[model samples]
Target: MIPQLIFLIIAIAAIALFTINIRKIIRNINLGRPEDRSDRPAERFMVMLKVAFGQTKMTKRPVAAVLHFFVYVGFIIINLEVLEIIIDGLFGTHRIFASPLGGLYNVLIGSFEILAALVLIGVIAFYARRNFLRLKRFTGVEMTKWPLSDANNILIIETLLMIAFLTMNAADYRLQQLGAQHYITAGSFPVSSLIAPLLPNSESALILIERAAWWFHIIGILAFLNYLPYSKHFHIIMAFPNTYYSNLEPKGEFSNMASVTNEVKAMLDPTFTPEPVAEGGKFGAKDVTDLSWKNLMEAYTCTECGRCTSVCPANITGKLLSPRKIMMDTRDRMEEIGRNIDKHGKDFKDERSLLNDYITQEEIWACTTCNACTEACPINIDPLAIIVELRRYSVMEDAQAPSSLNNMFGNTENNGAPWKYSPSDRFNWAND
Candidate 1:
């Protein structure tokens, strides 16, 4: 009973900390301007199902897709066993679902065991692929510090957790064989049976091992939950909503500035009026708050896989424009702002902006507006949107642009097209 009480307290504390962590992230994401993503419920749902849940986009690389699918599926299904663990821990019961679930419980436990082995294999393969083989995508300009360490840490933690789970089952199975008190013949253990013989034959050692492993598994999961917001592993939960709220427009379509579009409409129709900007509001995104909420969510949703960066033509051409870097920079800037708000007030100004501080003008300008980065993202994150927003801020608010683009804008204003010829020369080309 005392053990049960301790488990209950730990569980409650973990839940409270996780809630606080999630709320902080939600608030940070909300700092961005709001845009309606509630339209087309059916289409959004289908997109979420296909991209986020089905992982269709991840199939671009079959090897990774297969490996990641094992880990993803295992993570979901094996957690069902954790439900039984929680019940047992709370009620001081052993194999609480064994009788109610009966033979089906055996099948489920066996399947989880197989999945555990698969997850172990997948994690090992991934770690090897990242470190040993040295995949180019896994190592980039941003992969040196926390980004690199974060990925490896999650991999190691997952490996340890899976090992602990299997070790607990192995010790439990051996004890059940010994006809030990409270250790009944319950769920099947196919994979762990192999490990059973390798374990020490002493009942006391086996019991201690089983209890320790059980505690380690549960505690590790709780710790992982709290660590997610600070790590790239947050994508495991953020991907669904990020995919669902992702832009559904055609690739070639670019959203027009609402301020300019409304002004044009007001000129064409008497009843139309342009919406006024709030005081000190700029034309484009100079900081995280200027982007749409979806953009900010995409920032946090990014797991730094570098899939977007690998396919970027600009980066391929030796440009500094890494889409992965853009998202990481935006996420970092957002967190900085969130911390500032927490320490000071929401209205507190930090002379630093995401545009020049985190992301560079050179990096943003190098992009060709080609949607390749958007297509390559596994969870449907639109880093291209953030890039465009930054470009807009530069070109509009600061009136800063490359000389070539400035010339193009000038030509368009004078000649009705992006050409050096005047409007009077429009008919001269026909004669030529």
Candidate 2:
């Protein structure tokens, strides 16, 4: 009963902490401007299903897709065992489901064991790809010491967790063979049977191993749950809604602000009067708060895989614009602001912002608006959208576009084309 009481307390505390962390993230995401993405429910659901759940985009890289599929699917399926663990922790019962399920329980246990093995193998491959194989996608200026260490830490934690699970099963099976009290003779253990031989024959030693492993596994899972929000693995939870709220319009189509649309309308038609925009309204995003909630959500959803950066034409051509860095910077800045709000209250003012402070004007301008980054993102993270927003802020609000772009904008306005000559003189170039 004392053990059960302690488990209950720890479980409650872990869950509460996880809830608080998630709520903080939600608050940070909500700090962004609201843009309605609630239209087309069925289409959004399909997008989430295909991109987030099916992981269709990842299929382009077959090897990576298969390995990630094992980790993703295996983790989710194996966590079903957590349910049994929770039940046993609460009631002081062992193999609680084995009695009623009978042979089906054995099938379930066998499947879980197989998945755990696959997950372990997948983790090893992933670690090798990052550290040993030195994959290009995992190497970049953005892949700093912390990012590398964080990735490795999660991999090591997962490997240990899986080993602990298997070890627990092995020791439990050994106890069952010894006909120990409170050790149920249920569930098949194909993987653990081989491991059982290595465990101690003494009942006290076996019980200690089994109990220790069980405690470690559950405690590790609770720790991992809270750690998700701080790591790139937050994508595991953010991917769903992030993909669901995906921009459904054509990649090339830029979404216009309502006031800007009104101004454009008045320019083309004398009878159409433009509505007055609010005095404090800004032209474009200058910070995380100026961005749409979807953009902020995409920031949090980033896996930091660098696939987007690897495919970026600007980055490939030696420009300093890394799409992965853009998302990481946004997330980092947002988290900082969240902490500020927590400390000083929401009304506190700060001069720092996501634009020039985290991402520079040079980086924003390097973007080609090609959407290649968006295409490469596994979960539909639109890094180009953030770049566009920053560019808009620079050009419109600050009037700080590069000379070439300013020249083009001037020519387009004057001659109805992006050239030095007038519309009537366009044929003169042909004549030349």
Candidate 3:
């Protein structure tokens, strides 16, 4: 009873902490400007099914995809065992589902053992891919210290949790062999059966080891739950909604800002009178909050897998641009602002903006606007949109465009074309 009561207290506290952190994340995501992604419910549902559940994009990289799939599937299936653990923890009942599940429980446990072993192997491979293999995508400039540490930490935690689970099973099996009171010979642990012979011979020692392993596995899971909000692993939860709400329009389509469009419409209509620009109102995004909510969500959804950057022409050509870095910078800035809001108030202003602070003009100008990044993104993250918005702010608000762009802008305004030649001279190029 005492043990059950202690487990119950820890579980409840973990639940509360997880809930609070998830709520805070949602609140922060809501800080961006409003966007309408409510159209086409059926299409969105299919997209979520294909991208999130099916993992269609991951198939592009076969080896990593297979390993990741096993880990993902194993993690989900292992949660069933966690459910049984929770029941036993609460009721002080050992092998609570053994009798009812019968032979099926043995099958499930055997499958879980197989999957757990595969998950362990997969995680090790992932660690090797990052650390030993030093994959370019994984070791990019944006992947500095914390991001690299976070990736390794998640893999280590997962490997430890799987080991603890197997160790606990092995100990439990040994206890069952010794005619222990609470330990049952119901579930088949194929992987742990090999481990059982290596455990301590004493019954009490085996029980102690089992208890320690059990506690470690559950507690580690709880810690990982809370850690996701602060880690790139948050995509495990956000990927579904992110894919569902992805921009479904043509890739070349640029979102027209309502304020700018209204101004342009007024200018085109001679009957319309120009309204005075409101003080502090900006033409384009100067900070994270100025971006649409979808753009902000894209930042949160980034896996930092660097697929976008791997295919990015700018990054390939040795330019000062990385689509992956742009998303990371955006997320970092948004997190900074969120922390500031938590410390002060929602209306509190940070003097630093996304432009010239988080991202530079050189990086912005490096993009070819080819939409390759957007196409390469597994979760439909559009870093290009953020780049465009920031560049728009630099041009329209600051008027700090480069000399080449300024000349093109001037030609477009006067000659109605981007070329220096007049309209009548346009046919001259064709003749040449």
lDDT of 3 by residue, 250-279 (tens): 999988776776688788997777666432
Model 1: per-residue Cα lDDT over 1-432, one tens digit each: 898999999999999999998999999999989788999999999999999999999999999999999999999999999999999999999889999999999999999999999999999999999889999999778776899889999999999999999999999999999999999898899999999999999999999999999999999999998999999999999999999998889987988877767668888998976677542367779999999889999988999989999999999888888999999999999999999989999998999999999999899999988989999999988888888889889998887799999999999988898989878877886897
Candidate 2 local accuracy as lDDT?
0.92
TM per candidate comes to 0.97, 0.97, 0.96
Q: How many clashing residue pairs, candidate 3? A: 0
Per-residue lDDT of candidate 2, residues 156-267 (tens digit): 9999999999999999999998999999888788888888999989999999999999999999999999889899988999999999999999999998778788878998
Ranking by lDDT: 1, 2, 3
Q: Which stretches of candidate 3 lie above 4 Å from their native place? A: 272-280, 427-432
